[model samples]
Target: WNIENIIDNATLKYSVNFVEDVVNLDVSPGASGIGCTEMVISNLGTITIDVDVEVSGDNITISPGAVSVTLAPEGNITTPICALALTRSEARAHPVSVLALGRETNTHLNQVQVTSNFTAIVDPYARLSIQAPMPAKHCIGSTFWTNFTGVNNGNANDSVVFEVSNIQELEDAGFTFTLPILQYQLEPALLDPLKQNSFQNLVIKVDSENVTEGYYNMIVTIATTMDGESFSAATTYQIWMANCQEQDANIEDDSLPSISLIPTLIAIGIIAMRRRY
Candidate 1:
């Protein structure tokens, strides 16, 4: 009997095959700013084969990196793999190797080298501006509202965060004010390229009663997070405070002469009418 030939024939009868030699993974930013790819493994052997899958790369990560499958004769298995960019600034091609090894024979049966190329599609950038009420004036112990506009100069969706700092520095500079809502997070919005969005009627309370009556200047900082990075911008706001008591006094003084002249004019009209009669 030819036992050696039989063994060689059996070894050559069973084999493994990959559907595609090279897989191209598009690591482009998705809804969650992450990228993913799907892969399929097929078995062309007559008997069930146990195969193990793995991926090797720095930026690319595969879910279920180790997959065990008992593929029937001419059966296939599908796997979903996801990858993300560690840093968004640099866009380049990342080559990753997906190797499938036979568990029983401990042999490398199939290899699919994937080239994940990420382009510099869009850069995240933000522009912030604030518009307050005309005259920027408020009385003591009063609340004022301002309008905030955030524009996404780049091609990505983002959220805006507002913060007020340097209160002590402003007070030392003879301008003291208070923000009722110090930290605010704006709702996330998908901004088109070079398009603007408005957050209307944001409130800020000024403590004019405790501070002196004058122009209070302070800095308002705006920050946004895009592609897991923080970018910030700042602007100065000038708020004028008027003493409530002094405003009332001025109103009364301006109207006092008009109130006194009413009586004198009535008397003069009566005297003139009597002389004519």
Candidate 2:
């Protein structure tokens, strides 16, 4: 049953026709020797129509002398990576489509056309996790260690590099010397995998300097392999004068010295009284 014959000689009837329906279709003609013209007709319910036609050209021969093709319009593809915040101005984000080439009817044409429809919306998909033996604030003279964990939900391992900086301004702002000045590093232990579920840690050390008791601030900057790509995070630690100040003040307030002499004196007096009796 050729499509050209059915459209040309069939009777199409409508059980109910209330309003006017107009069908419109457009198709790009194929190359000189490669593609064929696609025709489509749409109506409410079913339409039975009668037609008479004659073919004159040898190149225009019809198939079964025709074929039936169900025309389905392309649909929108959902982009999951859209949730990540990507800098579209500096970077272009792309997606992996599920539709494979072999399954496509028109491999080259349809696949390319469908790929154009997939979209990715940008968001903050990059995540960071920091861990350390102690909090960011430590004594100025004390050595404290910390770890920073980062994940490129946006890219893979070796995709980004990191840096650590010592900020003196953090001390001027009131960070205590009791809390050591901080430094940071990305640990080698965390760089094996680069997935949304994967993460790497940055090990940080706060080495307190032998200076006035004050606080300090530290910053960690992460950059792409090229350094131009970077992000930053920070923590604080401090060192202060020893804790013996209060103990020194308390000693000064004692009215008398705490001595064992009183017990020896009283025992001697009792022995002398017994001897006299």
- Tens digits of per-residue lDDT, candidate 1, 1-277, equal 1111111123222232333333334323333334555556555555555666665555555454565666766677766555544433233445545555543233434332222222212234444444434447777666555544443332334566666656777556444454555344443233223322434234555444455678776566666665555667666677787788888889988966677698999999999999999
Residue pair clashes in candidate 1: none
What count of clashes does model 1 give? 0
TM-score of each: 0.40, 0.32
Alpha-carbon deviation at 31 in model 2, angstroms: 38
Model 2 CA lDDT for position 238: 33
- Over the stretch 48-87, how does candidate 2's per-residue lDDT look in tens digits? 2211111112222222122222222221111111112212
Q: Please count the clashing residue pairs in each candidate, in the order shown.
A: 0, 43
Root-mean-square deviation of each candidate, in angstroms? 13.0, 17.1
Task: Find the candidate with the highest lDDT and give its number.
Answer: 1
